[model samples]
Target: MKFKKQIFGFMDMLRFKKLVPNRREALANGPADPLPTEYRTNVLAHRLHPGRMEVELVDAVMVTPTIRKLTFRRTDADAFPFFRAGQYVSLQSPVGDSLVSRPYSIASSPREALENKLVLGVEDAGFFSGYLCRDAKPGDRFVMSEPSGEFHYETLRDKKHIVCIAGGSGITPFVSMAKSMAEGDEPYEMTLFYGARTAQQLAFRDELDALSAKGLKVVYVLSDETCDGCEHGFVSAALMEKYVDIRESSFFLCGPQAMYDFVLKELAPYDLPRKAVRKDAGSCGNREVSDPRTFRLTVHVRDKVCEISAQENETLLTAMERAGIDAPNKCRAGGCGYCHSKWVRGEYVVADGRDGRREADRKFGFIHPCVTYPASDIELIVPVGE
Candidate 1:
């Protein structure tokens, strides 16, 4: 045993002594080329997550009486970042004394986004949307946030078949989803139920017609007027069940509160799982107050401080935009937490069901300015705008 231990120890010593020479030899034989200046992973990361970008409006056409289809191209790059079909981007621009932005779902396919094109169907309803539909001209530039939101289909979480119920301008994301399916970029069967007040109010009819020929299922439901192919009524579960199996498919509803309430009630008897239904979170606008009170808002952005007047009914984001503060925000519905700020001191009310802050954010007094309305004078520290 002693002799065997001595031999093994000698062999180990010899192996340990050769480590330095072996390493030196390996190093000498290695390639002497300098490290790469750019890595593919980093390049891919930059491509996928550009944060924000400047975009130029290339074309604007009236898709319906109130909805305008606006096309955009990235001014900084050749193509916009490819995103999920149903995602939305917030476009911001200076409108007179105020900087305004709104989230619009992508109407074009992700493949079109890679070809230097993106599209939004903006209804002529809101302040900024009115500008886009009426006053804004081609070549006008705006800042666009990255595509985001949890409204897109997840293969693992959602069923293979999706039932998309769209109302008014809510047809935007479904249009993209249908186009994505037609383009073979996404793998899912989509059955879109587009609802409008009248057949004349339906947007994207011609495009949807062409896609229908390509095997994409589209049903036009008009409430006021009847057409040869359209079903004249609200898109209730009875109307949907006529075409597809609701039990074997997931539901995607994008529309006003009334439409959501109606559709949800219609499907309540089905007793579907929570994950089986998804809804788009539209931005929270001003609350309805009988007489809104004005309160002073002190905001700190980096080293700069500004004083703005906030209304009891309006959100902090609205106040900052009214003062041209350019506060950072993406999904202004409070779900994205992009406009999260340090609440130093304030009396505010978060919009009902709009408080989406995490436990850490709540414990640390961080508030999403987009959904918070000031009840008294407030002081906050906000991040720089994207």
Candidate 2:
């Protein structure tokens, strides 16, 4: 009986082995493409992380002579992605024959995005701003990337209290934060030191005043003119020390190049932790080009070759746009690495501290054209736009 049982067990094992699928046979019979799963077909995930969305300008209000508040609403999608208060969206615009993209910090709270509205406070300065302010209308269509940036406050990384230093249009992001905090979306104490030339140049004054009444500390510092109730001076370390406990707080800065230069120098004596100081990725430092001559630029995109004249002071991205070439770019500040191209030939000058390329990228002769200026006639292999 034991022998019979042993033989039966052996037979059962053999049958089980035969029923198991063979690896090679399974591979040969598998479908050529993967079938979509619930994870891949999720609607909420796609809505929250859509790469780009089509939006139309619904309203435009002039905040100041140089600043305009543009309101955008989604055209095709049901809603815009929810973004942090300090993140910015890149708006793509066609200027003449070329397409250009620029990032603007959202001035509205995250709740506003849920209502299908995004507000941008644009200051007329460069080519893109000129188009947005002068040429764009109420019904003009635009393609905007999802909100992105590393300028927002985080409870895990930042302290409970924050000191914000803003200049010019830089005050927009802080406005979003103030609104969010007032609405109970964010739980952090904020004190904003806003700098401007005069009272007339201060954008979003009324909105900020309302938020200030709701517990946001707002200090207006005027450099050129002093009001009866405003502080008269730049945002200096002395002024910051008067309001904030430097050792127990985090500092956030958003402004033009000159303001960043002066403010960072002013804060250096505090010897704060590296993580304690955060500057908006959009805050670009000043770079001077000694030469003022035009150089030849040869760009290779897929099978097409584009030749354009580049100025010594302007970036390669600017030259391509001027020539009506729609080159891809985001965070024009050089931190996003979206406009990276192969340097086929020629010399270029990358601003110091603006080179965010990886070590391997630098070693292999790749450069981000957004912040790379032509030092001489240049040749590049630019990636084709999707």
Could you give me the TM-score of model 1 versus the true structure? Answer: 0.93
Per-residue lDDT value at 63 in model 2: 95
Error of 1 at 233 (Å): 1.0
Backbone clashes counted, model 1: 0
lDDT of each: 0.93, 0.88
> For every model shown, what is its TM-score relative to the native structure?
0.93, 0.87
lDDT of 2 by residue, 247-348 (tens): 888888888879989988998888888999899876242357675889999999999998889988888988898788878777888888888999999999
lDDT of 1 by residue, 54-141 (tens): 9999999998999999999999988888899999999999998999988999999999989989999999998999999999889999
What total of clashing residue pairs does each candidate reach?
0, 0
The local distance difference test score of model 1 is 0.93
